[model samples]
Target chain A: MTLVGLAARNVLRNKFRAALTVAGVAVAIITFLLLRTVLWAWTAAADYAAKDRVVTRHKVTFIMTLPLSYAQSVRSLPQVKASTFCNWFGGKDPKHDKEFFGSLACDTETGFTVYDDMVVPPDVLDQWKHDAQGAIVGDVIAKKMNWKVGDRVTLQTGIYPKEGDWEFRISGIYQAKSKAVDRSTFIFHWKYLNDNLPANRKDQIGWIVSRVHDPSQAAGVGVAIDKVFDEKEIQTLSQDERAFNASFLASISAVLTAINIISVVILVIMALVLGNTIAMGVRERTNEYGVLKALGFSNKHVVMFIVVEAIVIGVAGGLLGLAIGYPFIEGGLGRFLEENMGSFFPYFKIDPRMSVLAMFLAVALAAAASVIPAISAARLKTVDALKRIA
Target chain B: MDTATEKAPASHRDKAEALVSLRGIVKIYERGGEQLKILDGLDLEIAKGSYEALMGPSGSGKSTLLNLIAGLDRPTAGSIDIGGKRIDQLNESQLARWRADTIGFIFQSYNLMPVLTAVENVELPLLLTKVPSSERRQRAQTALRVVGLEDRMDHFPRQLSGGQEQRVAIARAIVNDPALIVADEPTGDLDRKSADDILGILEQLNRELGKTIVMVTHDPAAAERAKVIRRLDKGQLK
Candidate 1:
């Protein structure tokens, strides 16, 4: 038999312990992949942001608003291709109070043009443009609320206090063409919201969104637009779409840091589990190593036996983890998140590189874990090792 | 003075040339800051094709001397020449190679790899050599046949009796066709019947195949089978 074959057979000598160790490594691998996927999905929005779009909001906070005239001024810039503005509605359906989704009041004429990733049927778009109180709902929200075209939906808002609930007709159900777009948003006409607002709030807008002619010049265009309002009564913070998403992510940087630390901790736990198994195996086989040495095998050969055994366990555990992890993440949890939490994780599938990395880490950590045991086994005196009972 | 040029006694020269020669052998081990000398300065010689047995009480250094001759351990101060090669001067790796090519070992416990079959255990030593896989298997089968355990070649150690396991270990020792066979209490763990069977095999190997055998044993019955019996007490030959 080959030396590697001998090492592999030794791993199966204590079947129950080896199986338990493999299971431990597999569980660690699954936890690692799950945390990594969460981190990846959280940052996917910034990674997939549209380069040509820039957002202009209040310098101090997103809660404050800019004047409606600021939209026209942004559109008048030489570099701006199209401009639109939206205000957060904070609308809730009384029927599904616990269900959370995004609601926005947007400019009807320029909203679809600036946010081009949202696809609506031409007939529905026409209806939404013509009707004063018409709204376009995303397909995910439409399915959840069971709303059809021409359905009358009433929403209660915490931001704007009206005499009664606001009413609108569902003119369109939109679908997202990119992962950057939330698939569960409700968009209505900003004019409908502005006309009903009190005199002081009538001319206010939440944020202005503009598309640039050249994506590479988006930063320069943002600077020029902010210059327009630099000395005005209200200063604006302008950024490209990616930078806007990054700033939003920075608000919860602690959560991201925790996920990162937890992912590394899982890898450390995997190494420990592998190391314990290898050390135990080496201890039990001390006499066998002596026998090998007496049979003209060197210390290097003893080290090989222990290291190869650890690596075999590592490979087996890695394969088992991937087998369970892929379906669990992509098929089960991913579908649930995309349906329920699409605002945060629009696309929640596992990345292929993550799978490769998990396998690589498993094997690498297994080898690293075996180092001390392998060296100890190699340094043992042949006569002393032969005297061991096992 | 170089021990290689030292003249041998007339009686040893009258027999076949010496296969193993030791001069001024001393082994010391330091434990907990105290030096314990196991084998004091000693000298011995074993001729080729001779069957010799080493006998002593506990802590008499018989095993230590056997280990020194087998190249399994080094002497703190001594010269060991086995099969015309100065083994005491060899490094750990070179000694391992030398042991593989020149000496076969049979332990008291029948230290067969529990994971490997009898034939595989026999073939293990050949892995370190340049022998082809097919030839290695053929040679292992031949060695098992020589020990009259050819039928049990595919059985694992746990499946075999103690006597049969010892036979398998013997097969492993002879599979490489080394010049010297060093056995440490080969029959220590066997019953009287099984021990007799193992001793008979060793006798046949020496008489029929002309293989030199050096064994360490406590049983007087086991020692009587050898052509020459040497006794050691407190690190000195008696």
Candidate 2:
């Protein structure tokens, strides 16, 4: 028999203990995958932001607005390819109060060009631009609310408190080119908000999304745009779209940190469970180890035997967890996140990298769990070990 | 240094001359921080092919004496010379190497690795040597054949009966053709018929193969098969 075969057999000496250890590792891998997915989603906004796009908002807060005249000034720049403005509708469906999505009042003609990654068919784009009271919804948002073509939907905006309600016709449904982006946004014509506003609030814009000639020149153009508006009464904070997303993520950084801490706790629990099982097995087979040593096997061999046993347990557990975990996330968690938190997570399936990392961790943790047991086994003297009964 | 060791036995090629000599040996153990002397000064001479038995009571330090001769435990004080080399002066790792090369042991209870088959258990000792994998297997099969267990080479220790397991253990011990064979109560756990058969096998290993045998046992029937009988009481041999 091979040395590895002996180790594998010894690991199965206590069937229940080996099974428990595999279960522990599987649970840890699941927790680790869940936390990693949250971290990935949180950081995806930063990773997938448009490189040639710059956003200018009110210096004090995004809650305030800029003048429509600022768009005219920004469009005048030589490096500026296109410029569009959008105001947050802060609108919610009265029926599904908890279901959130991006509701924006944007320049229908220029908004589509500036945010080209938010791709829609030519017919839908033309239809959306031609109809003034038309609102185009994302396909994911359409599916969730079960809205159809030519459907009239009313949105209640708390920010722009209206006389009764604001109504718009569903003109088109848009999809995201990149999975990093949410496909659940509802974009309406900016003129609708402007027409409903009082004369004092008219012509006010929430934020400007400007596409630059080159991604490398985006920062310089952003600076120049902010400089042009610096002389005005309202100041601006101009940054690349990625930095804008990072700032939003920073607001919920604490929650991400908590998930990370809990994930490490799960690893510790896995280590403890695996370590305890190894220790017990080693203790029971102390005399057998002495017998091996008496037969001229070195301490290194003894340690290798134990470590090999742990690795087998770890690999088995990791595979079992992946077997269960893939469907659990994709079929169960994936469906829930896409339906409820579509604004934040348009696609919530497990990434290939996350699955690989989980498998690697299982093997590493299995070997790591045996470290103490191996050392203890090596430290035992032949006479003392032989003296140990059972 | 004693001339009497040469006259003991000169029977076979494995033991053409005297190899190991013990002058004085003692072993002491510390338990619960209290010193307990297990073996006092004892002297024994063993030649190359002598088959001798050491008979003793439970407290007679027979196992302790066997451990010292096998180079497994260090004597508190004394010189143990084996194969013209002083074993007591050697380090623990060096002693282990020496034992692996020159000494073989069969315990009262068969100590074969439970996971291994009879052939694999026999091959374990050859792993310490520089033998190739194929040669190790060949040598293990040859040793199993010598013990009349070639048919059971593929059987695990658990699958073997008491006597067959003992035979496998013997095969593992002699797989390297060790010059010295030490059996401590080798037949104590077996019934009379099996014990007699095991003794018969040991007799063949000694008379035919010329292997020097040092056995410690409480059974007079086992000791009667040996050429010489030595009795130990307390720590001294009489």
Candidate 3:
């Protein structure tokens, strides 16, 4: 038998204990992968953000609105190719109160132009532009609510109170071409919303999104836009889309940090489980190690046997984790999260590189964990070891 | 035993070259902050191809002496020359190589790997050498055949009787054709029939293969089969 073959056979000497250790390591790997996927999904918005786009909002809070006149000033900038303004409708269907989705009242003409990644047919765009109360719903929301193009729907809003429910015609359905964009939004005309409001609130818009000619200069253009309103009654905060997404993520940084810490803790737990198993095996096989020494195998050979056994266990556990994790995360939980929490997790999928990294960590940590046991086994006196009965 | 009739004369043994020579050997172990000497300044020699048995009571340093001769442990002080090589001067790794080339071992508990089959256990020592896989298997089979356990080559240690397991251990020891074969209590755990079987195998290995065999045992019946039986009491040969 080969030395490696001998080491591998030793792993099966106590099948039940080895199986339990392997299962424990598999669980740790799954937990680590799940936490890493959460972190990855959270940062995916920023990673896929459009570089050519800038968002301008209130300096103090996103809840506050900018003056409607600010949209014109943003559009007039030389670097800006197009611009649009939208207000958060915060509307919900009374029939499905528990279901959450994004609702926005946007400038019908410029909304479609600024959000070029939102794909709508020419006929549908024409129909939406002419109708004052026309709405464009995302395919995901359309499928969820079972709303058709010609169907009329009513929504109740908490932000903008009305005497009765607001009504709109579903003029079109839109799909997202980029992962950064949510596929579950209800977009309607800002004019329809403003015309019904009192004079004091009529000319207020929530935010402005502008597409710039040069992506590299988008941040500079955002600075110029904020500078225009710096001395006005209300100040504006402007940033490129990626920085804007990052700022939003910073508000929930604590949750992300917890996930990161949990991921590391899982790896530590995996190492402990692996190390304990190897140590136990070494203790139980003390007499066998002595016998090997008597057969002229050196201390280095003894160390190799223990370390290789641990590595095999680690790799086996890693494969088991991957087999269970890929289906559960990418296929099962990912679909549920994308459907239910599309605004927070626009794209929920496992990163292929992360899978490879998890496997690599499993083997590396297993080897690291085996170090103490290997040394202990190698340092045993041959005569003393042979005297013990295992 | 039939093989005892083939034992060489004392003059023939004296004329043969010495396979092992020890000069002023000493071993000390520290316990509770005090030095405990196991083997004193002892000197001995054994001719090549001799079958000898060492018998001693508990704590008589019989096992320690065997360990020293096999290069499994270093002496606190002295020189050991085995198979024309000065083993006392060799470092740990060099001594391992030397032992691999010159020494084979059998244990009372039949220290065959539980995970490996009989043939696989025998093939273990060959992994240290540059032997090809096919030739290693063939040599291991041949060794098992020499021990008359070729039919049990595929059996695991747990599947075999005590006598059969010890035979496999013997096969593993001789697979590399070392110059010296050292057995510690080779039949200490066996029934009388099994013990006699093991003793007969040792005698046949000495006579047919001409391998020098040094065995440490507590059983006088086991020692009686050896051509030369030496006794030790309190670290001195008697």
Question: How does chain B score by TM in each prediction?
Answer: 0.94, 0.91, 0.95
Fraction of the native A-B contacts that model 3 recovers? 0.70
Predicted candidate 3 versus true structure: per-residue lDDT over A255-292, tens digit per residue: 99999999999999889889988998899899999888
The lDDT, on a scale of 0 to 1, for candidate 2 is 0.84
- TM-scores, one per candidate: 0.95, 0.92, 0.97
Q: By TM-score, how accurate is candidate 1?
A: 0.95
In terms of DockQ, the best-performing candidate is 3
Instruction: Sort all candidates by lDDT, best to worst.
Output: 1, 3, 2
lDDT of 1 by residue, A1-390 (tens): 899999989889999998998888888888889889988888888888999999999988999999999999999998999999999999988888877888999999999999988999888899899999899998888888898999998998899989888999999999998878888899999999999998988989999999999999999988999999999999999999999988989998999999999999999988987998899889988998988988899989998889899899888899999999988988899877877887888778787899999999998999899989999988998899999987
Q: Against the true structure, candidate 3 has what lDDT?
A: 0.90
Query: In model 3, which runs have C-alpha deviations exceeding 4 angstroms?
Result: B1-8
Off by over 4 Å in 2: B1-16
Q: Fnat of candidate 1, please? A: 0.70
Tens digits of per-residue lDDT for model 1, B43-83: 98888988888899989998999999999999999899998
State in Å the error of residue B216, model 1. Answer: 1.1
- Give Cα distance to truth, residue A234, candidate 1, Å: 0.8
Q: Candidate 1 local accuracy as lDDT?
A: 0.91
